[model samples]
Target: MRQTCVLLLFIVLTSCEYFNIKKTSPEAILKEELQTFNWNDVDEYPSFSECDSLTVKADKKVCFQQVLTTHISGFLQNEIIVVTKDISDTLVLNFQVSETGQLKLIDAKINALTKEEIPNIESLLYESLDSIPKIFPAIKRGQQVKTAFELPIIIKVN
Candidate 1:
């Protein structure tokens, strides 16, 4: 009787998942998921109404950039900017689209020569952005998210 009881207890303990398998807590699983998540990438890029029809991710991005460039170019072309020397440089515009679909300029990196030639370039860029159509914020994990972008604007004058 003693031998049989010991064998039964041993078998019961071995067959029970509580003793054999390791159980994970919800907090631990959540922490692991967060560690593996990529925060820098968004599932969908921000878009303008005109770009909303595009299906491909790359195409949508290209369309958004093209529209933005066009708007800024149009605004700048209307201004009479006279330069003494030929100026050919690129300006990097850093901006952000908020989750609420509002656009804001973070910074503008203009070369010394460009700034000397066009003192109001920053204001002009802001005005151009103001003229752009309403934008849709980026989407990540099915939630609207803010996104930052750096756009290069080429300034070429004869």
Candidate 2:
């Protein structure tokens, strides 16, 4: 009876380890869950209001980009700035689309020749983004997802 009880106890202990209920941290769990979707690729890109009616995916993509470019260009045109010296560089805009379809500007950087040339460039970029309408969030596997976008705008002062 003693031997039988010991065997039973061993079995119980081994079984518990076999069916180990691993306690995973919330961050670890989220990372594992997100692994199912490719972070670099989205099933559908975020769209602007003007792109809603486009049936073709390619057309929708182009339309969205065009509209975004137009809005940014218009905003830059409205901001009156005088360049004392000729400067040419690219301005990189980094932004994110929240899962709930909200546009958030992350960062804006200007490759300025001098600090005095565009001291308020970052704030100007933020104001320009603020003027934009709420963007539709990117879709991943038929579900809305938080996604990042990088837009490079060529700046030239002749």
Candidate 3:
């Protein structure tokens, strides 16, 4: 009957396994994934304290700080760079992480803060970010959410 055909059509349309498809990342696929993910998670990464937040979004909890314990030690041979030019010691590096947890540098800039006109401000911030060997991303539902991180590295010349 007509009712039977209409029912079959509705079931067929709803049962398509399209939305359940597992997406892969690549030049073209990567663009599509990023475009979709961008719309899904509108909430910012969870912060310990919030000034303007109405309710704490604790769902974005992080297990521990990213620790970089090896490799980037004095073995890397990092030394102080002299001021042959008007280079600011305060460097801000914006880094992005891929799905496989590889770091990709997006941008880096020299000291923006003028308080660095003080003594050894650059050395202190740089060492802290560099100290962590392995970077930890904010974890949500046991999945690593794509986010940018800032690493400040300063080497004391004196």
Candidate 4:
């Protein structure tokens, strides 16, 4: 009878999940999730009022870029830019949209020839960005996030 009781106790202890499975701590679980998460992607792209209606993420991004380019091009067209020689170059404008929807110009990469032709091109680009309408910041995991962009603008003047 004593041997039977000892055998029963052993079976019960071995079958219990507390003995067979290790408990996961909250910190360990969080760390594992963080390791698997992708940090470079955003749930939604930054947009203007006109782009807010789009449902697809890629469509929304394209619409945002189109609107921004139109606004900047329109602004630049209104200004008088005269060049002595034919000039064709691309200007890379690096800008950031803050979490609060504020636009800031980080850098303007203009070629030497373009800069020589237009002395105030940087300021012109900044002013054009400043004139853009209200922007909606990008979203990541249900939280608003800042995003940076590099837009290449072609400058062609004959």
Candidate 5:
């Protein structure tokens, strides 16, 4: 019981900081204005989905894996700037996008990555993700659309 209380306290404290940072309610992302098909009309966009249930650690891995195999190829097709070989790196970032659609990177940690690595990964990823269609079909009546949504994004070079 004491453990539960501790967990509850922890959640209360970090809820706004970790997850809700976006302030983008499930409805907003699903809305027609943002993606055309709210979570109700989800058509499976490969990456990104209603996967908040995942732990921060798991979410990080899922996002990285999804982007690499699913979206990296598309991004690489574009202009290649950095010639750096794949160097393993991990980052934990807190971000929020305003209603105006401005994406922001609040905080990030380069576990084992260098300063140059961060930007390279960021630039390449942002470019590649561009080809991705950001939209999800709205759900209705407790139905979870079995779509392969993008998890959190993480880049690693070995």
Candidate 6:
């Protein structure tokens, strides 16, 4: 009888472990799903209306950037205030494209010195970005995804 009880306990303990091993807790499953997500890069960059014709990914990115730079530069040239001092600084524009393919300007920043000297830079950048039409969102794994970009514009004051 003692031997029978020992054998049954052993079977119960081993089977319990086996059953436990087969089942994943909700937390564990969530963690595993999250781990599979890639954050570094997307399969396709965001698309601009002007960039639709480009077949290559690199070309698309280049065309989109060129169009953006042109728009920003043109707007600045037309609307920017004339500063008396010779100024050279980099303006960083951080923006995002939503999954719904709408562009949102997150932030615009220049060097502290530039900010002090050129108060209009931020507003001009924001206004120019606002003028841009809807942009297609980035794609990853066959699904539209929100994507962010940091564009640095070199500004020189004459």
Candidate with best TM-score:
4
Assess each prediction's global lDDT (C-alpha) against the native.
0.90, 0.79, 0.46, 0.89, 0.47, 0.82
lDDT digits (tens) for residues 56-148 of candidate 4: 999998998888888888898899999888888888888899999998889889899888989888889988987799999999999999999
Lowest-lDDT window of 10 residues in candidate 4?
Answer: 14-23
Could you give candidate 5's per-residue lDDT for residues 12-108 as a string of tens digits? 9888766644467777766746565355332222224444344464564455355444555445444544536675544454443332223344544
- lDDT tens readout by residue for model 2, 1-158: 99999999999988877786878899998898888756788788889877999877788768767777778878977888787887777877787889987877787776647346877777777777877876888888899999888877776666
Q: Candidate 1: where is the Cα deviation over 4 Å? A: 1-10, 17-23
Judged by whole-model lDDT over C-alpha atoms, candidate 1 comes out at: 0.90
**Is candidate 1 or 2 superior in lDDT?**
1
Ranking by lDDT: 1, 4, 6, 2, 5, 3
Encode model 1's per-residue lDDT on 30-147: one tens digit a residue.
Answer: 9999999999998899999999889998899899888888888888889889888898998899989999989898999999988998888899999888878999999999999999
Off by over 4 Å in 2: 1-37
Work out candidate 1's RMSD over C-alphas. Answer: 2.4
Off by over 4 Å in 6: 1-34
Candidate 6: pairs in clash: none
Q: Which ten residues in a row have the lowest lDDT in candidate 1?
A: 14-23
Each candidate's clash count: 0, 0, 9, 0, 20, 0
What TM-score does model 3 achieve against the real structure? 0.34
- Ten residues in sequence with the least summed lDDT for candidate 2: 107-116
Candidate 4 lDDT (Cα, 0 to 1): 0.89
Off by over 4 Å in 3: 1-88, 111-138
Once model 6 is optimally superposed onto the true structure by TM-score, how far is the C-alpha of residue 96 displaced, in angstroms? 0.9
Residue 117, model 3: lDDT of: 41
Estimated TM-score per prediction?
Answer: 0.88, 0.70, 0.34, 0.89, 0.32, 0.74
Candidate 2 TM-score versus the reference: 0.70
